[model samples]
Target: FDEDYLDPDSDINKMGRALALGGELDDFTASLKDTFTTPGSQWQYVSIDTHVIGMVVRGATGRSVTDLLSEKIITPMGLEHAPYYVTDGAGVAFVLGGLNLTTRDYARMGQMFLQNGRYNGQQIVPADWIAASTAPSAPTAEGQIGYGYQWWIPQGATEGEFMARGVYGQYIYINRADGVVIATNAADRKFREAGVSDQNIAIFRQISAALGGT
Candidate 1:
């Protein structure tokens, strides 16, 4: 299913609510079976997965994902001015890619991950979550890229390098070994073209090298 086709009032969306409410395997498995037979067999970048993950977070905690993220991630990082998701046409927080934040705030998040989920002497996100979320778990052929949980691992990054990227040229490139992070936001005319990726990667590499990476 096209991630963009997600309807806030659709059955899947309802399933997401159920999953968020601790509905158990009967809820999650039912949803998955309706979607696919086996996990990781087919590789598709569906935004609904992250939305469902948000649901899971909401269900696990008694708070909304937005609030939880703010309490745990944003506030601690001092991103009081971060641009969160406005209501979609359907009045739901578009969890797929609806978050907006300043370049410096995004860089702070990248730096947090580069520091292994520790920020300001506090462990915000679990280190295991950071590791697993940034590690490539599926194949991305046909000029596409590898996928982690909701992150992207470019082809030739070092063992501990990955990125948090979004559509229309939103990026936070994190290089842990070199202690470098490049945060960028752009309004490009041709967003999905190879030129954008190549240019961004080139810039990231140049910046990393300039930082004196071995």
Candidate 2:
């Protein structure tokens, strides 16, 4: 990985176009420093670490993460449409936040997690990986919520309650015990407001409780 190559400032099309241009992992790591503090030290809620995971997959197998995901996860489920990775100017798959799928497709992903990585009688993602990914890795300043690997756990959530949240109020709340997956896509007037997030969480919990999950 060429640190210089990954530096967002080094290129005009850092996240936009440079990412598609595959390069050494070091370059990606170097670019990542600007994205967050050391893992577990601080919570930034940024997309760089997810991208790093993609890089890790690529480095370990010498294959694009998109291909691996398709072979291992997507194809097995026979999803009507395959998810595609967005590329940066460099042509690297935008692992951070480039995934695009319909609400039903997103619900399928949540359902897979709800099943602990098993989908349609086949084990797609490892159960252990799912557990580790949903487990809290760090606490934000609010101390109410915690972040796991690319997933979010609400404060005081029961062991089985978790969520996959995205920007612009996109969310997938899963209650394993209740067998419910609440998927929502919204355009909140206020972005990143704690109150808004808290309200949404409250509503989700209400639904879960009404369904006898809580």
Best by lDDT: 2
Clashes of each: 1, 18
Please give the CA lDDT of all the candidate structures. Answer: 0.73, 0.74
Write the residue-wise lDDT of candidate 1 on 1-214 in tens digits.
3332245765556655654664542344334546554776678776657767766776788776677777888888777486667443334454656687878888888989999999988998899999998988777775567788888888777877889877667789988877888998877646666577877877887898789555
Name the lDDT value of residue 124 in candidate 1.
Answer: 89
Residue 164 lDDT, candidate 1, scale 0-100: 81
Query: What are the per-residue Cα lDDT tens digits for candidate 2 across 159-207?
Result: 7789988767889998887778898876665646659888888898899
Which residue segments of model 2 deviate by more than 4 Å?
1-40, 139-142
* Quality of model 2 by C-alpha lDDT: 0.74
